[model samples]
Target: MRIGCRQKMKSIIKSFNQQGFAILHGVLASACIEAVKRECEKLVDELATKLLALGRISDTYDDEPFEMRLIRLYENHPSETPTIFRRELHLRGFFELFAHPRLLTIAQAILGPEIRLYPNYSVRPKLPENRRTEVLWHQDAGYTSAEADILRMVNVWLPLVPVNVENGCMEFVPGSHRGGVVPHEKDEYYLRIHDDHIQPVVAQAVTIEINPGDVVIFSNLLFHRGLPNRSDHVRWSVDFRYQDATQPTLRNTQGHLLCSKKHPSNVVRDAVHWAELEFQ
Candidate 1:
C-alpha cells in the first residue's frame, strides 16, 4: 500500500480501537455511489408499481428526486415502505457495494485476511414520520441470541444520501463497546437498551453525519440508535457486518466469504455467483 493509504488505514484502525467506531469519508467512488442509488431507485419504482396495482397510490412520483420519491410513494401508505431488504441482496449493485475493495481492506485490517459478510445485512429507508423506521437505542449484539457476547464482528453503514441529525442519522456513545453486552428489552419495532444503562451514556452520544460515499464502521457492541427522520426526504442507508471467518457464528447459517487466503475457493467470485447463492 502507498504511504498515504497506509497512514489512513492506521488512523481508522486506531479510531475503531479507541472509540469502537470510525468514519471513512468519501471512500467510495462517485460511480459506485451512483450505481447503488440507481438500484435503490429501481426498488422504489417496483414498490410504486405494486402500490399502484393495489390502488394504494395514483401516481408513481417518477419525477421526484431519488430521496423524495420514496417518501411520496409511501406517504399515503406508510406501512408499504420497506425498512429492510435482505432477500434480494444479490442484486448487482448491492454486491458491488458489499464487496467494495476499500471497505474490504478496512475489514481485513481489523478481521485479518479471512472475512465473511454476515447474513443479517440490510438496506434501510427511514421515511418521514414513520414509526416503524425509527430504531431504538441498543447494541447491535443485543439483537442476537445469548451467544451474541462471544461473536466478533464489525458493522459497516453506508448512506445513499447525505445523513445528518435532520434525516435520522445514527448516534453513538463513544467507547460504549468496552462494557460488553448490556441488557436489552424487545420493543414494538426492535430491541432497546434498558433505561438505566443508556441514561448514563445518553448525554455523551455523538451524531454521525456523512455523505453518500462515506462509511461508518462500528463495533457490534457499541451503544447506538437511529434518530427520527425529522426531514421531509427519505434517509437511505445500507448496513452490513463482517466477521472473522475462523470464529463460530453460533448459528446454522454462514454468510458468504468476501475474501480468504486459506480457503480461496470459498470467496464469492462475482455478482452472478452472489445472485445464485441462497439468502442463507
Candidate 2:
C-alpha cells in the first residue's frame, strides 16, 4: 500500500513539473477527511460559544477601528482560540494536511527532500461579501520581494470544503508560470483589484475546482486569484506555501524579522522564521 502511494505521488510530481499545477483527486483518506471536518466544526462551535459568552461572535470587529482591525489576532487572541486567518493559525493537529506522507513525497520530488515551510501558512475563509479581499492576478513573489530571484515556491491550496468557479474557486492563467516575475502595482492587489497590470501571456484562463480531500499544488509565480464568491456560502481553504530553506525573508515594522529559522527542520516552527511581505 505504501509503495503504491509513493508511485502515485511520483506521477503527480511529474505532472506538476510539466505543468505549473496538479490536482490530486481524493488524496486524503476517508478517516483523515472526517477528522479534519470534525476539527474545523468543533473550532466553529467553540468560537460561537465564546462569542456568545463575551458578545464577540458577531459584533467584536464591527465597532473596532481600522488600526484595531489590523492588529494581529493570532497573538492577541487567547491561545485556545483557533487561529483561522492564515499566518498565525498553525492548526495543531491539522499539520497532517500539509505534511501528509503522500503530499510531502510529491513535494520532495519537486522541491527536493529538503523542503522548508514558507512561514506563511494561512486559512482564508471568504464570507459572503467579505470586504472584496479577492486577490488579483499576480505572481506570489511580487508579494514576497525579500526572497531571492532563484527561489522556487510552491503553494499547496487544500480546501476543507468543495470549491467551484462560482464560489471563489482559484482561477489561473495557464502557462503563466513560464513568464516568471511581472511588474505589479499596489493598486492591483488586495487593496484595489484590477487586471490591467497583469499582462495575459496565456490566452485561456482556467478555473480550478476541487472536492474535499483533494489538493491543488501550483507554482507561486503562476498568476492566480480567489475569484469573487457570488454564492451565499463561504469559501474556506488553507494555503501552505513552501520554499527552499536558504531564502531571505523581509523584516517587519517592530524590528523583528519573519521566517528566520536556524534549524528549518520542523513543520511547526515559529512565524518569526517564515518570509512575509507588506500588504499595501
Candidate 3:
C-alpha cells in the first residue's frame, strides 16, 4: 500500500521501524522540485560551457529537457561524464529540500530531535548502461566505517523524475535491517552483499518506484541496491542522511545541524544561511 503524506505519520514511522524502510508519497511540492531542477540545469550549463570552451562540443543542448540535457551534453564523452555531485550542493535552492520540516520530523522520530545532515550527502545522476552508475547490494553502514554501523541515522532518497525498474529505481529487502551489518565484498565498481548472505533474501526484494514528490526513508543498515538504468534518459536523484547530532561524525568535516534543542542557535537558520555555508 502507498503511504501518502496526509495519512497518519505514525504509521509511516511504524513501517520504517518494522520494515526498515517506508515510501512517503506527495512529500514535496511542485515548486520545490522545480527549484532543484533549475539548480541542476545550472550545474549542467556550467559543465557545458567548460566543454564548449575546450571545443569538446559544438552544441550546448540548452533546449533539451531536464531529463536529457546532461545525457546530450556528454554523449560524445562518456568517460568524462560525472556520475556523482557533492561539493556543488551548497546552492540556496537545495536548502528547502534539506531542511524540509516534514522530512526532519520523520528523521527526528527515527533519530532524536537533534538532527545533523550527515556528511555523506550526494546527488547522483544514473546514466543509461553506465557501469559506473550501477550500484550493487550493500548496506550503507558497511561502506562508511565500523563505527558508522552504530550511528543513529536515516537515509533519504528523492527523485527528480519518475522512477521505475526500467530507469534504475532502488530495490530493498524488507526488514533486512534487523540482521545487522552483513559481510560485504568489493565488486568491480561498487560493493555487493556476500552471495551466501543475500541469496536467501533475494526473493524478498521489492522495487521502489516513485515520483518527484515522493521520498524513501530507510535505515543505514537496510540491504539495498540501485538497478541498472536501461532507459534512454538519465535517472536523476538526490540522497542524504540525518544523524543524531550528539555523536561524533567520525570524519574531518562535520555536517550542518538541521534541528537541535541543546544548541538551537547553531541550526541552519534559513535558505540564505544554508547557501552561505559550505558542505562541511
TM, every model: 0.96, 0.72, 0.96
Maximum-lDDT candidate? 3
Model 1 has an lDDT value of 0.89
Cα lDDT, model 3, residue 43: 91
The segments of candidate 3 whose C-alpha lies over 4 angstroms from its true place after superposition are 1-7
How much is the lDDT of residue 79 in candidate 1?
Answer: 71
What global local distance difference test value does model 2 have? 0.60
lDDT of 3 by residue, 178-216 (tens): 988889999999989999989999999999999999999
The positional error of residue 23 in candidate 3, measured at the CA in angstroms, is 0.7
lDDT of 2 by residue, 48-70 (tens): 55665775444334343311221
- Which 10 successive residues of model 1 have the least lDDT summed? 72-81
TM-score of 2: 0.72
